[model samples]
Target: MRVVHVASEVFPFSRSGGLGDVLGALPAQQARLGAQVTVVSPWYADITQAVREVWRGPLEVPGSVPLTDVRVGAFTEGGVQFLFVGLDAFDRPGLYFPDDVWRFTQFGRAVLPALEQVGVVPDVLHGHDWQAGLVVARARLAGLRAVFSVHNLQYQGRWNLMDGVGWTGLPDGVFTAEGLEFHGDVNLMKAGLVFASQVTTVSPTYAQEITTPEYGEGLDGLLIRLTHEGRLSGILNGLDQERWDPRTDADITPFGQLAGKAACGAALRAEFGLDDAPILATVSRLAEQKGMDLLIAALPELTRAWNVVVLGGGDPRLEAGLREWDAHPRVAFAQGMNEPLAHRIYAGADAFAMPSRFEPCGLSQMIAMRYGTLPVVRETGGLVDTVPHEVGFRFAGATPEALADACAAARLTFDDHAEWAARAQEAMSLDFSWDGPTREYLGLYARVLSGPLRPLVGLERA
Candidate 1:
C-alpha cells in the first residue's frame, strides 16, 4: 500500500523536536513493513542534501483557486521518499513565516498535482499535526482516503474567519463554531478531525486525556465528538533503535555493560568530567510545557550532592538562565542541539530527568532507557506507558516538590550500585520497537479502505 506522510518537519533535515524524530523513523519502519511511504515537507535552510526539483506547476486551492506554479523537489534516503515543496515564501529559514495560512494552504493544495505528476496516488494519506492537516483534508476532498495523527492538539492552525476562509477557499459555513471554525477562526486541525477517515493520537492515555478540558487545549469537545463517532484511536510512538542503541552509538566513549550498572556509571562519569558525583542529565526543549521552570526552581535544592548536565535550547529566559548556571562548579549546560552530546549525556548520566507537565509520547525518555540510564519522569502520556514503576521513579503531581522527590529517589538508586544495576539491565532489555505500532496502523488502514474492521485486527483494544 502507498502511504504519504505530510508534515512541516522531518528529522536530520528540518527538526524542531520529537515530531521530527517520529517522521524520520516511522516512515522507514512503514517501508520495512512493505508499504510505500513518502514524506511531504517544506524546504528549510538547514537541509543541505542535494534535492532535485521535479516540477513547477500551477495548483488550484479553495479561495484564489489560481493555477499558480509551485516548485517541487524529490529526495530519497533510507528507502523512504521525500517531497520538498518549495515556495519562495517557505524557502526561508522558518517553515511558516509571514503568511503561514497561505504557505500551508498552497502546500496542501499543491500536493495532489505533485503526486499526479509523480504518477503515484497513495492508498493512505497520513497527515501529521496542523501544518499538514489541511493537505490531508484537501486530499480527502479530492477523493483520497486519509488518516490524521494528532501529535499534540494544542497547536491547532487557527486563523481569523476572513483570512482563513479566503486562503482556504472554504465555505463560510466552515467558519462556524462547530465545523472547521473555532471561536470565529478556521482551525486547520479541526478540519482534519472533521474530514479524516480516522484520527489517531500518539498514546492511549493521551487519547483519553485530550477528551478532557485540561489537556484538550479547547479541542476536547471536538475530540469527544470524534470518539463518539468512532473515528478516533490511539497508538503509542516508538524510538528509532538504530540511532538510540548504546552498544553501537558513535557518540558515547564507553560502550555498553550488558549486566552491570556500577561499571556503566563510572565510565559515564569519566567521560563527562564528573568525578563520581551522581550525574543527572536532561535533554529537552526548555519550555513551560516541558516543566523546565519547575526543573530550574528545583535545582537550588538539588545541587547539594548531584551534578547536572542540560542539553537543548528554547525559551530565551530558560536558555539565558542556564547559560549563567553553566559556570557553576557542578552544573553543565550545553545550551543548544548537539546530537552526539545528547547521546553522551544519555550514556554518562546516572539518571535522566523529564518532568513534563504533559508529554504526548517522549522519545528521549525511551532513548535514555535504552542507554541504561534510569529515567526520573512525571507520570503522564507515554512516560506513564513506557517508564515502568520498577525501571525508575515517577512523580504523581506536576510540582517542583514532586519532581525533586523523584530525583532524590533516582539518586538513591544511583548511590546503590546493585539496585541501579538491576534496574538498568531491566530497562536495556525492554523492547520499544515500531513493529507493533506499524502493524496496528496497517490494520487500521486496511479497515478504513475495506469499509470495516478486518477480522485479523480484532479491534477490541490490545
Candidate 2:
C-alpha cells in the first residue's frame, strides 16, 4: 500500500508537540511494514537542521493557482520515508505566517501537483490535524481516497467564510454543520471529517470522547454521526523505540551505560542537580490541556517530599508559576524543548509525572517507561494504554489531589529500591513501538479499500 501524509509539522523538522513526534515516527514505522510513504510538510527557515534540498519545479495549487515547488530531502531515522516539499510560500520564518488559513489552504491545495512532480500518486492521502484538512476535501473532488487523523478536535482550523470558500472553490452546499461550517465560519477540521474516506483519532477513548459534547468542541454530533455511519476509528500512537530506548541512548551517558537501578540513580542525581532528593520530572507543554495548573497547585505539598524538575514551555501562566515558586535546592524548572536535556531528564529522573486532563495519546509517559522511569499518570487516553498496571501509579480523576497523591505514591515507591527496580524492569519491557500501530493502520487501510467509502472519494490536481 502507498500512503502519502500531508501535515503542517513532522518531527525533527517542525515540532511543537506530540503531533510532530507522531508524524515523524509513524510514517517511518509504516514504511518498514511494507507501505511506501511520503510526507509533505512546510519547509520552515529553521528546518535547515533536518532538510536538505532534493528536487525543485513549478507546481499549481488551488485548482489552477501556481506556486514554485522546491522538493527537499528528508532523513527518516527509523523505518519511514520522508520528503519535505519546500514552497516559496513557506520561505518565510513563521509556519502559520501572517495568514495561517491562506498559508495552509495553499499548502493543502498544492500537495497533489507536488506529489505528481515526485512521480507517485499514493493509494491513500492521509491528512493530520487541520493543517492538512483541506487536502482531503480537494482529494474528494479529484477522485482519490483520503484519510484524516484528528490529533486534537478542539484545534479545528476555523476561518472567515469568504476566505475559506474562495480558497477551496467547493460549492456553497459544502459549508454546513454537516460539512465545513461551524458557527457561521468555515471549519477546516469539519471538512476533513466530512470528506475523508476514514476519520481516526489517536485513541479509542478519545474517539469516543470526541463524539460527545464535552470533548467534541461542538463537533461531537457530527462525529457521532460519522461513527454511526461507520466512518470513524481510533489507533493509539506509538513511540520511536530506537531513539527512546534507555540502554543505547548516548544522552544519558554513564547512567544508560549501566542498566540495573544503582548506577542509574547515581547518574540521575548528577544530571538534574537533585543528587540528594528524589527527582520527579514532568516533560510537557505548559498548558491547560496537560493540567500544568494542577501540577503547580500540588507543588507546595509536593516540595515537602520530592525534588521536582519541569521541562516544558507554553502559557505565560506556567512560566510564572514555575518562576514565582520559592527557590529550593530540590526544585528546578527547565522551560522549553531540549532533546539531549529531555533524554537526560527521562533517564535521570526517579519518576515522571503526566497528570493530563485529557491526553489523546501521550508519548512522554511511554518514553519515560522505556527509560525505566516510573510514570505517575492520570488513567486517560494513551497514558492508560501505554503505562502498565504494575509498572506505575495511576489515578482516575484529573484533579490536584489525585495528582498529588499519585506523586506521593511515586515518591514512597521510589524509596523502595527493590519494588522500584521490579517496576522499572516491567516498564522497560512494555512495547509501545510503531510496529503494532502501523499494522493496525494497514488493516484500517485495507478495510477502507474494500468498503463502500473507497469509491465515494476523489482527488483532483491543481
Candidate 3:
C-alpha cells in the first residue's frame, strides 16, 4: 500500500510537539512493514538541519490565487521518503508564523499537484491535525481516498469565512454549521472530521472521550455523529524504542554501567543535589491539560515523603507554581526539553508522574516504563490503555486528592523493595512498539480501500 501523509510538522525538519514524533517514527515504521510512504510538510525558513535528497520540481500550486511559486522537493533517509513543499510562503521563522492559515492552505492544495509531478498517486493520503485537515477534504472532493488523524482537538485552525473561503477557494457550502464552520469562523479541522472516509484519534479511549461533551473541546456533537455513522475510530500511537532504550543510551548511565536504578538514583540525586528520598519525576509541558495544577496542589503532601524532579516548560502561571514549589528542598525543577537529562531522569527516577487530565496517547509514561521506572498516572486516554496495575500505579480522577492518593500508593509500593523491583521489571517488559499500531493502521487502510465513503456529504456549495 502507498500512503502520502500531510502534516504541518515532522521531526528533524520541523517540530513543536508529539505530532512530529509520531509522524517521524510511524512513517518509517510503516515503510519497514512494506508500505510505501511519503510525507508532505512545510519547509520552514530556519530548517537547515536536513540536507535535501533531490530537487523534484519547481511546480506551481494549481488554481492558486495571488499566484505564488513553490518548489517541490524529495528527501529519502532512514528508509522513509519525504516530499517537502518549499516556497517563500513557508520561509518563516519558528514552527508557527504570522499567516499560518494561509501557509497551510497553500500547503494542503499543493499535495495533489506535487504528487502528480512525481508521478505517484497514493492509495491513501493521511492528514494530521488541523494543519493538514484541508488536504483530506481536498483529496476527498477530488474523489481520492484519504484518512484524517486528530492529534489534538484544542487548536482547530480557525479564520474569517471570507479569508478562508477566498484563500483556499473552498466551496461556500463547506463553511456552514454542518461543514467547516465553527461558530462564526471557518474551522480547518472540520474539513477532516466531516469529509474524510474515516476519522481517527491517537488512542481508543481518547476516541471515545472526544465523542462526549466533556472532553470534546466543543466538537463532541459532530464527533458523536461521526461515531454513530461508524466513521470515527482510534489507533494507539507507539514508541521509537531505538532512541528510548536505557541499556544502550549514551547520555544516561545505563543499569549495566551502574549497579542498577539504586546506584543510578543515588548518583543523580548527588548530581542534582536532591535528597536521597524516593525520586518521583515528571517530564511534560506544564499545562493544566497535563494536570500540572493537580501536581502543584499535591506537592506539599507529596514532597513530604518523596523527592521530586520535573522537566519541561509551558504557561507562565505554571512556571510560577513550579517556582513556588521549588521552595521545598526535596523538589527540583528543570525547565525545557533536555534529551540527555530526560533519559537520565527516567532511568534514575523510582516513579514517573503523569497526572494528565486528558492525554491523547501520551508517550512519556510508556518511555518511563521502558527505562524501568514505573509510572503513576491518571486513568485517562493512553495512560489507562498502556499502564495497568501490574506495571504501574493509577488513579481514577484528575483532582488533587486523587493524584495524592495515587502518589501515596506509589510511595507505599516504593517502600516495599521486593514488590517495587517486581513492578519495575514488569513495566520495563511492557511493549509499546510500532509494529502493533502500524499493522492496525494498515488494516484500517485496507478496509477503507475496500469500502471508501464517496461523495462525502456536506462538502459541496449550497
* Candidate that scores best on lDDT: 3
Assess every candidate by TM-score. 0.93, 0.91, 0.94
For candidate 3, write residues 1-462 as lDDT tens digits: 999899988987877778988988999999999999998888777777664645454555443464356666677877888888776777667778667887788777777777787777889989999988888878887888888999988878889877787777667777789888888887889888888888999999999999888889899999999899888998999998987887878876666322366767877798778886889999998899999999989998998889999988988898888987776789888888887888889888988999998998999998988888889999988888889878798998889999989999989888898888888888887888999999999998998999945664655563
- Using TM-score as the yardstick, the better of models 2 and 3 is 3
Regions of candidate 3 where Cα sits further than 4 Å from its true position: 53-67, 256-259, 460-462
The order by descending TM-score is: 3, 1, 2
Q: Give me the overall lDDT of model 3.
A: 0.84
lDDT of each: 0.81, 0.80, 0.84
* Tens-digit per-residue lDDT, 1-462, candidate 2: 889898899877788888898988888878878888888887777776655566687665543345665565565555656677666667777555547777777777777766776686888889999988888887876778888999988788889886778776666667665578789888898889888888999988888878877788898888988898888988999888887877677776534422654566567566556747777888989998999999899998888888888888888988889877637677788887788888878887778889888888888998888877889999877777778779999998889999998888888887898888889888877888888888989988887777664443222112
Q: What local lDDT does model 2 show for residue 9?
A: 92
lDDT of 3 at 200: 94
- Residue pairs in steric clash, candidate 1? 62-169, 63-169
Using TM-score, give the best candidate's number. Answer: 3
- Compute the lDDT of residue 461 as modeled in candidate 1: 21
Kindly report which residue stretches of model 1 are placed more than 4 angstroms away from their true locations once superposed: 65-67, 96-99, 258-273, 452-462
The residue pairs in collision within model 2 are 28-80, 139-458, 142-458, 142-459, 142-460, 143-458, 143-459, 144-458, 144-459
Report the Cα lDDT for residue 359, model 1. Answer: 91
**Clash number by candidate, in order:** 2, 9, 0
